[model samples]
Every structure is written in structure tokens, then in C-alpha cells.
Target chain A: MSTSIVPSERAADRGALAAPLDDGPRQREARAGRRRSATRIALGGALPILLIALWYAATAFDWVPAHKLPSPDAVIVAGIDLWERGLLGMHITISVQRVLLGFAIGAAAGLVIGAIVGLSRFADGVLAPTVGAVRAVPSLAWVPLLILYLGFGEDSKVTLVAIGALFPVYTTVAGALRHVDPHLVEMGRAYGYTRSRLLLTVQLPAVIPAIISGLRLALAQAWLFLVAAELVGSTMGLGFLLIESQGNLRYDRLFLAILALGVIGKTTDALIGIGERALLKRWG
Target chain B: MSLSQRTTTLESPALPVSLRGVGRSFGSGRKELPTTVLRDVDLDVTAGEIVALIGPSGCGKSTLLRQISGLDTPTAGSITIDDRSIAPADQRCAMAFQEPRLLPWRTAARNVQLGLARGLDRARGAERVAELLELVHLSHARDQRPREISGGMAQRVSLARALARGPGVLLLDEPFGALDALTRLSMQDLLVDIHAAEPTTIVFVTHDVDEALILADRVVLLGSEPDLPGATIRRVISVPGSRPRDRADAELGELRAELLDGLGVPSHHSHH
Candidate 1:
């Protein structure tokens, strides 16, 4: 019975495959490519769905203690409890605002300083070593110094995030600006562009793709430092929620906070990806 | 009206160029010996004249063109355009390098606009860019980026950009050397047409002797003498011709042979 069923299934599969081949090679390829991506997306979701199912099963079957690992439903209920109290939205908004403000400030400073060091040999000689040394310091190490100087308020937190955002942009922009095609720069000079005009017209556009990548890296750094900033001394934020829930032994809320951070970070990164695609279409 | 004639009205009057004892050398530092590339080079280019500089490879022909365009200063002499001393990045001259060097992000029309005189009103600049694209027969490609175009088309856009500057003297450093043979011939003819229309003083460096014969009013040869430290003008031959000269003309063929011989290449033509 199994052998008979196998032959029929093989014949049906071959028939389905043959139907698309009759449409011409290009159309067939297009269908095949679509099918491939669809399969990829399905495969990607499969593991996550399986993990969630395992979590539900373990909790329902009492395979794990509830104190240590909460069920998926318990985490969702914790999220709703915070939402009803209006704390979840506030935490998310404050964290996002901190990241954005820090990112903008750091990126602007990076561009200006990077241009200076990149364009002028004298500036590069004077500043590059010091900048490199500073960049070598770990992200967490800046937390104490920033806190000491700026205090444990919003100033310290934002400053820490800004510091985190700065190094990536600076390094990428400086390196990229230095390596812009010499032929193009010479062409700009021949056309009577010099100083600022040369930078704006030729140098900047030549490195747009690099600049965008640097910005994306800086954004990720911004989020990282935001958590560090909130984790250490913050009164509110997702990071604060993590610490507070742990202190209260609310494991469900702790898991909720972790999930929120993961989702938010992924979403922001995806947004940057969309912007990158649009920019590359224009400038690439 | 034809494109060239219509655009000619916008061009600046051609300017004469004179070089006196022009020379260039590299590495004149305290610890390093200087290497001369060109020494004691002198030439006079009349207004509206087309001169071709030809030589063997690494013979300083391009360095000479750069000196004239004021992109590089001669270590030992004075160069003047329209009796004014040349300065760095002089407004009197514009140059097109061997490579098209178009900015990849910019459209062909926008690249041409890069050559417009500073502070020109927006409308006039756009008008001039359009005129130049038409002059190069690149109006259809005006909206295309550099990578989207073929080698020959990109070079044409580069030419249009240089022309848009309305320069008194145009300097080209083997501008069509990268094109295929058929495309190069067309480019040479197009250059001749452009010259006939605008009459700008053009000084171009080329490796092809036949190309020099077809395009130049005078071909100036630069080569290193047996004992000399650097290259200099070795021979100047007058190409007796007019606009749109026949490529297969017997006289041009003879001149081509002479030029090839001067550059130390044996021209297989048997002497009678």
C-alpha cells in the first residue's frame, strides 16, 4: 500500500513541475525564484513557532517551575498589566527618544570631525591617534565617567548613548572619506571646486553608501548604550523595568521586558534597512 | 540652426597660450634625488589652433598638458594664456582626462553642469547644460548615470562638461584613448566639428600618430634625447589640412609614417 501511494505522489509532483516549465524559461525561473523565497520565509518562521510551542507545552505539562520560566501567556498578561497602568508606553517612548536624540547629536559631530581628519593630513596626524585610543575603550567603561561628569539624570544617560553612537560613524566616515577615488577628487579640483565646495559636491556624494552604513551601525550602538544607561541608574525605561521586575521576583514581567527590547531593536534595524535601500537606489 | 552653430554663440573667444622654459621634476626633497619629467619645454599655441602632443609612453606629454591647464605648475618656467600669467586651477582653461571621470551618482546633464561658470543664474546654467548635451549628441542620454552609459557615451559627456566651461583653451589628455577603434574615429571627427564651431584653442595629448595627423593643425613631438635627463619638444610638424580632412589622404599617410618613425616605431611603409 505504501509503495503504491509513493508512485502516485511522485507522478503528481512531476506533473505540477512540468506545468510551469511549459510557460517558457523566464516565466518558469520567475516562478521558481518566488517559490524559493516563500520557502525561505516559511523556514525562517518555523523555528520561532516551534520554540513558542515548546514553551507552552513545558509550562502546561509542569515540566519547568513557573518561578524560573514563565509561560508565553503569562508574559503577555504581564505586558497587558503594564499597559493598563500606562507604564509600558511611557517606557518605550522614553527609550526611543533617548536613542534618537543621542544618535542625531553623535552623528553630526562625527561627520564634521571625520571630514576634518579625512581631508587634512595635519588634522589626521594630530587627532587620529587620540581618537583611536578613545575608541578602544569599551562601551560600558564610558558609563562611570559619563555618570561622574554629567550626573545620573537624563544628561548622563543621553551622553552615554551619544558616546556609543559616535565611534562607529567617526571611524567609517573618516576611513571612507580618505579612500574616495583620487581621480574624481582631481577632476573636482580641475573644475574649480576647492575647500568646502569640493567636500560637499564630490567627497560626500562619493561616500554616501559608506555614510549610510555608518549611520546604521551608529543607530544600533545608540540602542545598546540606551539600555546600558537605563540599566545602571534609570528610574524608568525598559531597562528599568528589567531591574524592577527582578527585584520584585516577577519573572513574567522580566521576560516581557526582554521580549519588548528584542522586538523594538529588530523593528528599528528593519526601518534603517528600508532607508538604506531607498538611499542606495538613489546614490549607489 | 545646427547644434554647433547655435551653441557657438555662447562660447568665449579663444585665447593664445605661450610657454617659456617650462619644466617639471619630482622629489626635490633634501634627502632624495630629483627626477625630471620635462625640462626646458617651450611652445606657442595660437588662438583657435588645434595642436597635438604625441610621444612614447611615460614621455611627459600629459605633464605638459597639465602645466598648460594650470593643474600642475612647471618647476622652471612661465606659462601665459592671453598674456595673463597662469595660476593654479586657472579659469582660462578646462581639461578632460583620458578617463571620463564622471561622478557615478550624477546624470549626464548634471555632470555637464559641473563645468558651468560659478554663480551663473539657474536658468542659464540649465540651458547651457542642455546645449552641451545636444552638441555631443547625448541628449538622449542626458538623464542617464555614468555607469548606465557605454565608454564612448561617457567620454562624450566628459567632453560636453569641459566644453560647458566656455574655456579660453581646452586641454585633453588622451580623452579617447579608452574607446574602441571605430568609436575613436567618430570621436576624432566630432572633436573636429566642435573645433570648427567654437574655435577654442585646443591642446591634446595622443599616442596615435594617425589621430594626430587627422585632428591637429600642428603635431608637436616630445621625446627624451639620448643624454638628456627629461623629455622635451623634439619635432614639430605642420599638418597641411583643413577641417574634415580625409583620413586616407596620401600626405596624411606620409606624415603619419614620419611621426611613427620619430616615436621610434618602424612604419612598415617602404621608401621609394
Candidate 2:
């Protein structure tokens, strides 16, 4: 890629000044964003750096017990130990499976109900008010009631995750239909489309972006609720490890559990974002 | 409100559409705050004739075209199309807009085929689509997605689509206004050729006077909202000489000047 042999004068000038060569439009945009993100991340590290400095200072001055606030070095050791023990993978797998299953059930139920509500005044009148009311009640509020029905088991966790996942799906579908462009629908009518065909073709195509957005939010929420639900006397989950480690004063292990949660959550979130970008490229 | 109710008011022959003293004001039962978009309008559009509508921006030309397409009804005066009030089953009119609004996900052939949905059985649909692609000289690009084609090609496909329904009337709302000069001229010539072959009745709306003079059988000018004859200026500029009419022809230049003068737009901004 040396520019010494370049014939063009503009290229020679650009090369002499060391102006960075750019790729295609998409690659150029991605490189620009990557640089910005790197800069921001570097600047953001300063605050955390200061906090770590203060904590180290406080521990060195014997202001607090070392056991109480485990050294960052100890947390790193514990993280490596857990990684070797295979507990990290097992916990993550369980959480992800619960989230996916729960998300699937909620998405299907919510989509059906949302369509019914969107299309029919009768369904809206009968179901919307009740669902709205139920959605207002937090997942924690339902913990006691769910336990009564399904006991302190996977059933209760799945039910709670479903509860958390349902509202986004319902709102997105109903809102999308309500916002479906009338002009597009007019085009459909002019094309001699039947009522059902209008829904299948024009209406569904217009709603796809919103539908994908809803699915992403629901999946993320399901994971959030699954971990929260797992916190309730959970035997073998990241959340259970987190709670149990706290009681045993194994601060390093607790931090490791929390770190594992953050890492896995971040990875799943990134994957969802990547999926959204790829889907939007093809459809949006 | 119903087909039976509208029958009494729908008899006319010369103009396929005639709105007599039409006035429409939309509001939520609040007369004091009514949005009077069109008023006391009388217009006549003869069949198989291209009528170019020229006016200052925001003169309700698009709304008027919508009325002609039977997509909307006038609030006061009666609008009759082919001696029948516009109904849900009416399929005699088709429209093309500024952007070539082809379904992005569908192939070029499928988009043209969308217009022929009325009679398509699987194989026949594909065949009809192929025939239309040939008409637009887009046969080679039939299987390609809309994203794969240039702007001019997309527009040609859109025209083929509008013709797919066998529309007796074609309504174009600034269809080529978005194209570059070269592509625009190409499309204009293509449209003239297509119109000459089939004689599809058209209501072509453009701010370009030369465009109107070249394609229109008559150039009608509507004044600013709240002015009348409702159709303020009407000139029958017969496109009689031939296809590929010389742009330098004295008759065309004169008509273009008159159309620009009528619409009160300077020829320099539009003609060139």
C-alpha cells in the first residue's frame, strides 16, 4: 500500500500529507464510528481510574477492612478460578435458555392479543383495560402470587419472565397497526386487495421494523426478569451464586458472579444489536 | 353516501370527470375553524386527452388529482367519473407519484405484476409481467430487485405497473420532477411514446411548462386557493404535429411561453 510509485498528482499530494486512505462508503462510516467509540471509551476510563485510585488509597490507609472491599486483584483471581470451575458457562446457559423459552411464549401470546385488540373494538373493550392493569403491576409484586400457583420452581421463574416480556410485544404490534400509513393502505385498496390481503401484505410490511424492535426489547427484558426471578431461593444460577457468595463473605466470588452477569449481558446485548443492524439492512 | 344515492348526479360525456362548483372544507364539526383546501371549483377533463395542471406551489393540485382518481369525494359539488360516482369497486384510474414507489422487497417484474393481480393465475401472471417489462424495455432487468436498478429504470417499471391494471386513465403527479435532467428528458420521451401508442387518458401535473406543452393536449391553470373560474386558465394546446416533436418548434415554444405566462411562472426557471 506504499504510495511512492503512485502516478497521479492528487494521490501523490495526499500521500505526502499522509491523508488516510478511505475504503467504500460503508467501510468509511464504520471506521469513523470505531475511532469515535475508542476515543470516548478512553475518556470514560478516567473516572473509573480515579475511583480505583481512591479505593486503593483508602485500603492502604487502613480506613476499612480488606475483606470488606476485596482488592481488584482478588476479584480477578476469583473470576479466573470460576472460569476454570465451569460454573460460569453453566449459569449463563441456564439463564439464556430460560429467557428464550419465556420470551417465545410471551411473544406469541402478546402478538395474538395485540392483533385482536388492534383490529376489533370488542376485543379492545374486553381485554385492553385488563391487560393494561396487569402490566402496571411489577414482576416483584407477582412473585408471592406466582409462587402460590407454581411454587418456588422453574414454573414461577418462567411465568415471571413471561410477564416481563409481554407488554413490549403487545404495545409494539398495536402501535404499529395504529400507525400503519393510510396512504399505503389506499394504494392497497386501489390494487383491488381484499381486507385480509391488505393485512398480510401492506400492513405487515409496514409493521416489520416495529415488530423487530419489539422482539429485541422483549428478549432483553426476559433475561433481566429471569435473573431477578432466579434470585428468589434459586439453587443453581448466576443470581443464586451471587446471593449465596454474599452470605459466605466470599466478596471475590460475589464480584466474579456480578462480573459474569455484566459480561454475558453485554455480549447478548451486542449480539441483539448486531442482529438488528443486519435485519434492518435487509428490510428497513 | 351510497351508489344508489350518487346515480342521480353522475351523467356527463365530454369530460370523463366534471366537478360542478365543488367546495370541500374539512373540520371536526367546527365551521369557524374549517380548513378550506378547495373551493367552488369547476373542472372538466376530456377522455384520452392529457391535461397539464400548472399553478403556484400549494394550490391544491395534488388534492384535485386525488379527487379525479376517485380516492376522495368533494364535499359540496358532485364529481362524476365516466358518468358514475366513484365507488369502492372502481378500478378505471391509476396514479404514479414523484418517487417511484415500487415495493422494495419485490423484483421489478413482480412490481409490474402487482398491477395485473386482478386476473393473474400463477403462470399467466408471470407471462403478463414479462410482457409489460418488454413494453418498458426493462425485460433484461425483470428479475432484479428495485435497489439494483437506477432511478430512471425504476420509474419506467413504475409506469409499467400503473399500466398493468389497464387503466383507462393515468394520473401523474410530478412523476419526473425528481429525476436528473438527462433521465427526466428520457422519461418524458418514453411517456410521450407510450401515450401515443395507447392513448391513455391522463391528467399530468407539472410545474414545468415545456413538459406540459410537450405532453398535454390542453394546459389548464388553477389560481391560488379561493380564485375562480376555478380553472382560471384553459388553453387547448393540441399535441398534433407528431412524436419527438422538435423542442425548437415555434408552436411548442409559443405554447410553453403561454403556459408559463398563464401559470405566472417565468419561462427561464422552467422551460430550460
Candidate 3:
């Protein structure tokens, strides 16, 4: 009985060893993963396509008045009109510039202040309550104060967007740094790593995922505050286009501006998403 | 051969560790009462010696190892390596924790390089890391992340990382406590082989009596008396064998029974 069982087990073992010679399962898994992502992309686009079709049908049938809801073609024509006049490019470029500048300045300040507060109990105790109270004030309330100090030019608008970008990054970074695995930090200390070296080698790497998420949230916030900044007072931006088109009773141009805002916001978000994936692959 | 003969034969780079009246207590704040963990502990480990610290649960064996590694300060006395007082994270010592504590993002080779002395040149550091990885039988896993490896393999990486420092004293705090029984036995043999290859002063904490007998030249038992507030050295037994002793030797069996009895567990002979 033992001899028969051993022979069968050896055959099974040989079969298992021979299976991977062709790399069968691994290739199958890669194909399956590609198929799954393809399916995901199709599913994500399905709703948008259906909604566009419904809009076209509604307009073609005169279901909603054209004055209130312009046809998709009309919005496209308005966009082309603005592009021909050079207004569309200036608006997009100015808006993107404001968002990027505000995000860079605010995220940098957040990271530095967050590191200080996270690593030092004294700083946290002294600064936390005041920062919390400041954050509690509605972001819109900062609009008047920023304009009062920096005037109605690009400075006031950029400063408002910077305030919007700061808090999320500060909160997430400070919280993440506070909770970086204490065991790993202890190991770093055991290896004679000095304080700053320990922070760089262990603590910062451990919190890279949190930092990226914080940056993503801050980017979204920067866009929100940019609209607020431009809506209050400005000459050239998608937000200014919103007020202008509405005042002139050009609903198609208003729709064009809204669509432009959505596309640009999503495009910036996807850019950060790409960076997130790469950073996680390296550090996660 | 006896331990003395073996020690005298090798020109060891290992450092001797001396603990004099060492003690530790926690929670000395105004709002909290002080709790003593270790008190009045003293031991002198010779260079190139393998000493195993064995004790019951919560007996401060790990805390004592920390004091020697300079990862924690003793509230009472002093610990010196090679006749010099230990500093915080002293360069003379390296430690492998119970959990491996490898940086999850770094490959096995990079994690081991973390142990290299701060100012060492790049080429020598890389060479040292490669050699240590080979020593721990993990050269094949040099590029694998900690999460990609098994627990036993990660522990081996941890050991390799500790050895990369070329420390005069190596400290281990139950480094094999999390591994399976078979893996634990193999790791014990690997450790013996490592010591033979590059003899260093090793102080390890373990709860396994048989493991202590198999590896240590001297086994130091720590425990607390009924009236004492904290644990201290209760007995220091010198095993009668050289490196890599037979696990089933009669002398070791008797000694194991005695050690078990000292730890408040009944031996098989005692039951009979």
C-alpha cells in the first residue's frame, strides 16, 4: 500500500513541476487582468455615453426649450466661437496657472508645518488649537479678507486658492506622520540613525501614500477656491466666463464654461492619480 | 573542548558586555505610580560567548537585552561593552527584534544595508550587505521585499541586517519566537553555523529551555522573588559542551529538567 501511494504522489509532484515550465497560470492571469481593466473602462464610459445620447434626443425632439437647455452642438459652437476670439485659451491657461501656483505654495507650507507639528508635542500643543479654529472659519469668509489685504488682482485670487489647498494636506500629513509605525522607527533608532536621517529613511517613506492622498484632496480644494476667487472679481477665467455668459443671457456659452471646468478639473485629478500610482509602486 | 579553551583559541573581535546593578522602572511621572520591571541585575559575558537569557513571562528578559543594546536606559546602574559605557544606540552593538521589523518597502539587500555604519563608503557597504545576506542563507532573496518572503525568511533578513553592522556585540530578543517549530530548529542550527563562521558576543532572550541548552555556553535564568518588586538574575548555569552540542545528550537532558523545574514547570522525571 505504501509503495503504490508513494508512486502516485511522485507522479502528482512531477505533474506540478512540469506545469510551470510553460508559465501557463502566470500568462493566464496577465490576460485576465488586461481583460478586467478593459471591462472597467467600458463600464465607466457607459453612463456618460448614455447621458449624451439622451441630451441629443431631448434637444432633437424639442422636449426642453432651447433657451434653457441648449443642444450639445450649440455648446460646441459657443466653445468654437470663444476659441476663434482667443478668449477660450486665455481663460483655460489663466485658471490652470492659478490652480497650479496655489497648490504648489500651499502644499509646500503644509508639509513643512505638518512635519514640525507631527514630530514635536510642544508644537502640536501650541499650534493645534489655533489652526483648528482658523480651519473652522468658512473658506468663503477668507475671500473678503484676502481681497482687503492683497487687492482685487491675481494676488488676492491666488491667495484665496492657496488657503483652500492648505488644510487637507496639513491635516493628513500631520496625522500620518504621528502614526508612522513606531516599531520601524525604533528599529531605525537602534541602527544609530540621527533624528533627521531617521525621519527621511523611515518616517517619510512610511507615509508616502498618505501624502499623495493629501495632495490629491488639496488639488480639488484649489480648484474650488479658484472658482470662488474668480467669481468675486476677475477678467479672464472659466469662473468669470460663468458670470459673463449668464449676465449676457448666453446659456450656450455658460454651458461651455461649465463643461470646460469639469474637463479641466478631472484632467488635473487624473494627472495626480498617475503620480499616485507611480509613487505607490515605488514606496507602498 | 570547554568554552574557555575555545574562547582563548580564537582571536575574536567580539566585545565583552558587563552589567552592574542594572535596573529599570517605568511611569515616574507625577500622575502615575512607578512600576519596576528589572532590578539589581548583574552579569558579565565574555568576548565570543553565547549567552541565552531564559525566564518566565514578563520577567524583563527583553528589557535587559535592550539595556545592553543601548535602546533603553537602565534607571539604576550601568552597562558597558568592551569596558566603555554604552551610549544610546551605541555603534558597538546591533539588535534583531522579535518581529523582524524590516522596512516593508525596501528589498532584503537594502534593509540589510540599513545596519551599515553611517560613514562607511558605498562600495564596501554594498559588499558587506552582500556577504551578510549570503551568511544568513538569503542571497537568493536579496531583491525580494519583506512582505514577499515568509516569516522565517524575513527573520533571516533581520539577522543579516543586524550582522551588517559588524558589531562587537549582537543582541536578539526572541528572534525565533514567531517561527514554526521546524523553522525554529533550523534557525538554531543556522545561528550556530553563523557563530562558528564569525564569533561575536551574542546575548539572546528565549523561553525555550532546549534551545537555550543547544545554543548557549551559559544560560542565565531571570525571575522575581515573592517579596521583590522586579525580576533579577536567579541562576546562571554553565552548560558542559562546546559549540553545536547534541540536542539529545543525557547531560543536556538532565540540565533541561533542572532548568524547567527552576522555571516552575514539572519535568517528566519529576512526574514519574
What TM-score goes with each of the models? 0.91, 0.73, 0.92
**A6-80, model 2: which lDDT tens digit per residue?**
578766666568646634688788889999999998997888799778877767776879888777778788877
Per-candidate Cα lDDT values, in order, are 0.91, 0.75, 0.90
Candidate 1 is graded, for docking, as medium
Chain A only: list TM-scores of all candidates.
Answer: 0.85, 0.79, 0.89
Q: Which digits, one per residue and each the tens of the lDDT, describe model 1 over residues B13-117?
A: 899999999999999899999999999988999999999999999999999999888888999989999999998989889999999999999999999999888
Candidates 1 and 2: which is better by TM-score?
1
Per-candidate DockQ versus the true complex?
0.66, 0.26, 0.65
Between which residue pairs do clashes occur in model 1? none
Q: Which candidate order results from sorting by DockQ in descending order?
A: 1, 3, 2
Worst 10 residues of 2 chain B by lDDT: B6-15
Name the best candidate (by DockQ): 1
Please give, for residues A1-284, the per-residue lDDT of candidate 1 as tens digits. Answer: 35566877877876788765556687878888999989998998899899999999999999999789999999999899999999999999999889989998988888888888988999999999999998888888888888889888889888888888888889889999999999999999999999999998999998889988999999999988888888887898898999899899999999898888888988888898899999998889
Measured with C-alpha atoms, the lDDT of residue B212 in candidate 3 is: 95
Candidate 1 regions with alpha-carbon error over 4 angstroms: A1-40, A61-63, B1-9
**Clash number by candidate, in order:** 0, 0, 0
